[model samples]
Structures are given as C-alpha cells and as structure tokens.
Target: MQPYRPSPSPARRTVLRGSLAASAAVSLGARPAPAQARSGRPRAAWGVQTGDVTSSSGLVWVRSDRPARMVVETSATESFRRPRRWEGPLLGPDTDCTGTTALRGLPPGTQIHYRVTLADPDDPRRTGEPVYGTFRTAPARRRDGVRFLWSGDIAGQGWGINPDIGGFRAYEEMRRLDPDFFLCSGDTVYADGPLLPSVTLPDGRVWRNLMTEEKAKVAETLDEYRGVFRYNLLDHNVRAFNAQVPSIVQWDDHEVRNNWYPGQILDDPRYGEKDVDVLAARAGRAFGEYFPVRAPSAGRIHRVVRHGPLLDVFVLDMRTYRNANSPGRQADDTTGILGTEQLAWLKRELARSRAVWKVLAADMPLGLVVPDGAVDFEAVAQGDPGVPLGRELQIAELLRFIKHRRITGTLWLTADVHYTSAQHYLPERAAFQDFAPFWEFVSGPLAAGGFPANALDGTFGPERVFVRAPQRANVSPMESPQYFGEVDIDGDSGELTVRLRAEGGTVLFSQVLRPGRVGQ
Candidate 1:
C-alpha cells in the first residue's frame, strides 16, 4: 500500500480539468440547494435507490437532510394502493444521515414501486415530500429475460459534476436503458481526486466544475470521505438515475487513493496522514453507508449477487485484501491481487453457482498492465509475457480450476483504464495454457477524465478484439463521450449479448455468447 512518489503520468494520478462556466449553478433536480436543508422538515432530496436484489428481497437506501425517521411504502403499482409499510432506521450524523432498509418477501420478477419518506425525528406529523423509486426483482423462472448495465470510474481525475453540460450525463443515459440493475464495477467515488473550480482546456473551452469545500482537496478525514459521496449525489442526473436503477456497487483504489493497497504508508506530500490502512478504513465505512450493497460482513465488499436462474454476479474486492503493490515477478505468491481468503471464496462460489452466466465483476482488468509506479504493479497483470508470475499465478489457478471443473458461462467485466474494450483469452496463445477461452469486457469513466488504453499482458494471452480509448492522456469528458456496458440474457434462447455503449445511445462494440459454452 505504500505507493512510491507520484509522477505526472496519467496512469498514476488523474490530471485535473478547466474553468467554471457561468451556468455552473444549474441543479440536476433531486438534489436541493443548501438553504432548503436548513429550514425544511427533513428533506430526502438526495433521492432513493435499491441494490443486492434477489427474487424475494433487496436493500432500499436513502439520505435525509436532517435527523429523521426513514419510512418506506411499497406496492405492486406506483399508485400506492394497498401498500406495505416498512419502518426503517433513524438517520443521523453517525452514518452521514444515510441508512438502508432491508425489504423481504417481495414477488419474484415483479416491478416494485416504493417511496421513501423522511419524518422529523421528534415530530410525528412533520414529514418531507416522498422520494419515489423502483426496481425489478430477479426472475424465479427461466422464461423471464434479464438485462443490466455495468460501468465505473465515476467523477475521477478532476472532471467533476458539470451542470452546464448537464451534470453526469452518463447516468441519465443509462437510466433510460431501464436495466434491471447496474453493476458499478469500481472507483465508485474518486475520493483522492479533488475538484478545481475551473481550468482552461486545450481548445480554449472553459470546463467548469461544481465544487465544495471537501472536494477542493483530497479527502482525508471521515467527513471528507462522506462529502465525496455526497458531492456525486448533488448531480440531479445521478439522483434521478438512482430513483430508477438499483446498483451492485463495489470499490477500487480511487475510493481511497490512486493505486492504493493495504498496509502501505504514503510517501506523497499531499497527505498529512501517512498511514494508508487508516485512510482505507474510513473510506470503507463511507462506502458501506453510501452504497446499497449486501456485504456478507461489516468490512466485506466481495459477494455473489444471484439473479435467479439466468445469472450470478461475483463482485470482487481487489482492494481490501490484496498483497502490497510489487514488481509482480515473484515466483511463488499465493497472496496476490485477491488475497488467499477471497480467492477461496471466489472458487467456492463459482463451484456452487448453477446460473447460466457467472459475471466476474472485477474492479480492475485482469490482463492489463496497471502500474503502481515505475516498478510496482497495481492489477492482476504486469508486462511479463512468461508463465504465470505473482498475481498471474492466482488468476492462472482460478482459470485452471474453471477449465478442470468444467465450470461454464463465466466472463469478466471491469472499468479502470477509462476506455471500452473487448478482449478474448485463449489457452492456445497463452504461456500457461491450462484455462479455457473466455471474454473480458471493459468500460468506464462515467463522468471523469478519459485516458489512453493500457497495454495487455501476454501471460493470459488476451487479444484486444475491440477498443475505444482517448487519443491522449487525461482527455476530459467534453472531448470524449462517457461509456458503459450492457448485458441482455434471453430467457427463451438463453443467449447473452454484451454491448459496449457510449453517451447518446451509440453502441460502439458488441458480442454474443451462447449459454454454458466457451470460445464464442
């Protein structure tokens, strides 16, 4: 976790953006102005969302402007006729005024319409306007088709919420797709990437950022980390999108710092606190409070989200239990990117899964060369083209297990390189050829700065069939359209189609795979 001295490279720390536009004050909608939170009966302007959903249960989340009692009413229809009432937690500052309500006994494959009401903690009659939301439960039968979106790297590299171009435009675009759920691959918050008021772009356009005190610098304290999440929620498009799409959220290094790991002390002068473990702990707490995830334990971020008979998403926590960033040339390293325990858990879950498709929702790309500095590596792969080394050994082990065990219908989805690409890994072309052929889809930078593509490591024998990356390093969103990926599973045909999409509904790349099959 002790990353070396920072350099000006785009792969290291994200470069910032340009000046504030005159229309910077424009609101996205569900986010209220500062004054409204002060004088009103507890407001739910932050909006409502649900996540980790199953056929019979899910988690509902909301935030209040003040200390209030959370109340939820759910019905089959939006009309609220014969609704079931669920009394939730008492929102307070302990959790940054945010809390999640666990809803159970829901109808499978049904659309759930729910509204969140924030009642004053002391006054029974004083309440805020209800913030409504909806989500579809996982199907109980195979005949029900399923669809969902996956993307990450939100508000990173100094490109923050820009009200002028409509803050976080990608969320609005993704919300319209109406996916059953969104797998927020990782880097859900750029706590380390601070916002500047404005900077002049290369082409003379002034890119303005919606700034706050905590966003002005790196998030170090717990409140500052909470502000990082709160800052993103200020975008009206994000809030509006949350009201519709439930998300399966996870975290990456940017949630705490750039290319961070466990137990490393910081060498960077930008930070006053040198211990990274302390920083990661605070970041994890804020992440749990902000995101609607069904973590198995208090600090666990890895879990399998079962979506009935069609799919099961194995969300990985590459950041939490990872071995320190190294040169990645170790001969015998059992504790690599995913520590031994997580690897075991993943193997157990993959073996137990009976779904047609098992999506490995990894925070970082598997075969890409993500460097921690000039020497150390960040992700699963380094530039080595030889047999499995360091983290590659762990990945090789997992792949060999899949091939040997005859576990079918597994693919990888990730977003950290700030680009969209499709890669196919074949054992025939790999140094360690004990694995079956599989596909890995990458997409992201939801509302952040885009960067050039990273080089692939040959140990996995990955062929980049398709890629859409920025021409230069740290390209602002204005110069590049944001990206996301979608998956559609046909219940009748049992075929899964993956589409890499850009902002404004353009499908950049796509591929189709048959169920329980390989080498598509």
Candidate 2:
C-alpha cells in the first residue's frame, strides 16, 4: 500500500515561513515569550506528559518555548537522587519546538517518576526548570488492577483559556482522580472553533476567554493548526494535569472541522478555504507533532493497545478511513466507515487477542443520528430506519463477524455527543440480530459546549439506559455540566466498573459487569 501523503498547499508554505520567522525571532531574543512563559523562569511552556504506555515501554512528550535540546531523567524515586538519563528528540522549528522520546525497559506495574529538562541546543550547559511527571507502566501480571479516565472535546465553542481561576478546572479534578492514564477519545483541539475574547451569557453576565492570534480564526495554515494545539497548553490546569497524568489521544471532526470527511467541500463561512482534504492534512500533521502517539504504519491511526491479560484497547481512526457523508446505494457500496482494510485489521486483532476484556475506544457512536445540513452526515447511523445503508453496512458486518467468532467481554466507549449516557444494545430487539448484545458508554466535552441528547437509530437496537444532557444548546462551562468517564477493571474477578462523572468529580452513573456476563 502506498503511504498517505499530504498534498502541498500555498497556505502551508506561508505557514512554514511564518513559523521559521517566529523561531528566528525567538532565538535572537527579539520577541517576548508566550503568555504562559514567565519572564525569569525556564522555557518549559507546555509542561511534560507521558503516553502510549505498555508493559515495558512508554513515550514522553515535551514542548519548549524556544529551540532547545530535550532531555529526560527517570527514576523510581521522585527525589531524583538516583536517575537514568535518556536523550530525546530535538525541539526545533520543524515541529514547532516540540518533540517526544520513547522510554524502553521500564518495570511493569511500577511507578516511574521522571523529569524533563530543556537546554540550549548549541550549549548544553544552560538548562531550564525541570518539569516532573510520573506514570505506572501497564502491568505484566494478569492479577494487577487497571484504572483509567476517558474524555474528549477540549476548548471548543469559543471557550478558550481563562486566566482568572486556571483554565479548564475539570482537568484539575481529573488529575486528582490519580488514574494510570487518560483515554482522550477525540476532539483534542477544535481547529474549526474560533475563540473570541468575551461573550455575554443569556443571563446578561459576561464570560471571558483568553485569546491568541491563531485561535481567533479558523485554522487554514499549518501554524494556525499548530496554534490550536498550542492554545490548550496555555492553561495552567491543563499543563499541571498533563505533567501528572499520561494520555492516549484520538482525533474527531473538530480537530479538523465540524463533522468533516474525506473529499468533502466545506460550505461554512468561517473557513476561507472550501477544500476539506487540505485542512485535514494540516490538522493531521499538527495532531501528530503535538501528541505522544506513535506514527501509524499504514497511514492510519487504527491500532491495538494490549494491557497485559487485563484489557486490549482497540483505538479506531474512524475519520481517516471513512467515506464522504452522502446518501447513496450502488452495486458496490463497500466505501463505508472503517473501509475494507481497517475492518479486516479489527477482526483479526479481536480474534487474536487473549485479554480478559476488549475495549473499543471509538471516536463516534454506533447508533447516534448525527445529521449534516438537511441530508446526510458522519457516523454509523445513516438515518435509515429499515435495512443498513452507507456506513451502517460496514458496522453490521463487523458485528456479525464478532458474533460468529464469539468474541466475549467486548464493550464500546465513545465521547463526541458532548453529553453523558449509557446505552445498551440487544440483538433480539434490533433490525440486525446476528451480533451479540453489548453495552456502549458515552461521556465527554471536558471543557466545551453542553448540547442536548441525540436520537438513536433502530438498526442496532440501542436503548438509552441513562442520559444527562443540558437543557440549552452551546452552554458555557461556567454554568454548564462537563463530563468524563472512568473504568476500573478488577484483577482477580475480571469485573469492569464504568463511571460517568461530572465537572467536580461527581459520579452521575455507575455500572459493574463481569467479563462473561456483558452480553447477557
């Protein structure tokens, strides 16, 4: 297969020149540091994070305020009395002064305390303030318990960094939970959502958002897309949270634009460019550079994460391999969601996995009706109440394969709806009955607009067991309810407990299911 390459655009060239000029200015001390960077302090602007963890290895990510050589020191002790140093990738203008390093030969189930150091690329003698972080590697033993948090949609709907009382307080609350890692389902950044300085609420009160030049408009240039990622790092709460907790991130529509797909021409007035593919290419590159995810082998982000004998997380890249959102039926309708290659990979991975529980960390829901304009939109449900059509055909086939293979203990977790809900799918009550019954938990919008509930399609028999949505649309985080989900898997009994939490760490719903009893 040919590698997926981004097409060249004139806007991308302009972005490159701008970034290079900015880097040169920073190096010469002609420009001041970013708002988050203190005058006297060292240049660790975004703090540090660890991610993509396994039993014996992990990845650490850092971004500097200027060009620097990145270095990491890890130890079992937090005091750093005895540490092992690992040289990291250079933080340069190419990747917007950001880089990542893979740490290998880590001890499983052991807490690893680490600190990041940035020094002058030319002179290693001058170093900056060290940012500390800790991560417990995935357990190699089967009896070790597992706990992680999952959420999505950050800094959306004109909600940007608020310097008043630390931006995005939900992250601080999530950090306090002390989970091993965070599964960021999607919408890590909203390149399409422009940030304004302030807006008046319905009650006549003014809400303020900390704004930057790049975030004030739609991200058409590469620097603008990179700025979308950089904008979130300006928040102190986000930085502190990242320094303490690792994350497994995926991208959704907002990461490029609202409900974008391949080869679709956007008609939104906010965007100057109508080509969705060009925007997606820039967004994809920025997302890869900013996050700690490994490079995809097949030019797609669909991969499996095995956490010993406890769980296997199948992170699906629904957006990359999806067909355009349109209504059609032809002799060959194979151009659906997941495509052909990804669906085959998913089935093979599911069949070969030996973990007690399989978690499908999907970016979009299976039965939710997400309509675009007046006609069609993205997601598995094509609004067809009868037989499967469009993406639903691919989903139906996958479900049938799972049932045929008797893949047990599989649960789906997703976030894109900007609400919290627990859904149950029964094969007997559905349009399709070849698949086994399963549960899907939805939670998200860590700090974004709160939306109302969405209707479900009957193609897969999704019943809302519990749902919590805002009464109004586009509600602010100050008065609106934000949500996240947590999963805890018992070591001995292999029971998985799922919890949907609100802004201040309140559990809205809770359910516990054993491995063998999920479908039943």
User: 1-520, model 1: which lDDT tens digit per residue?
Assistant: 1111122222101100000111123343223334334676876666777899999999999887778899999998766899999999898878778889999999999988887888987885899767777788999998898899999999888899887898898887786677888999899889998888886789999889988888889989998898888888787777767777789998899989998888889998989998999999999999989988665238899999899999999999998888988999999999988999999999999999999999999999998899887899999898999999989999999999999889999999999999999999998888989999999999997988898899999998999999999989889999999999989898999989999999878888879899877455
CA lDDT of each prediction against the hidden true structure: 0.85, 0.80
Best by TM-score: 1
Clashes of each: 7, 0
lDDT of 2 by residue, 376-425 (tens): 76788866666677788888888898888888999999999999999999
Off by over 4 Å in 2: 1-42, 296-299, 328-332
Span of 10 residues, lowest total lDDT, candidate 2: 22-31
lDDT of 1 at 383: 92
Checking candidate 2 for backbone clashes, the offending pairs are: none
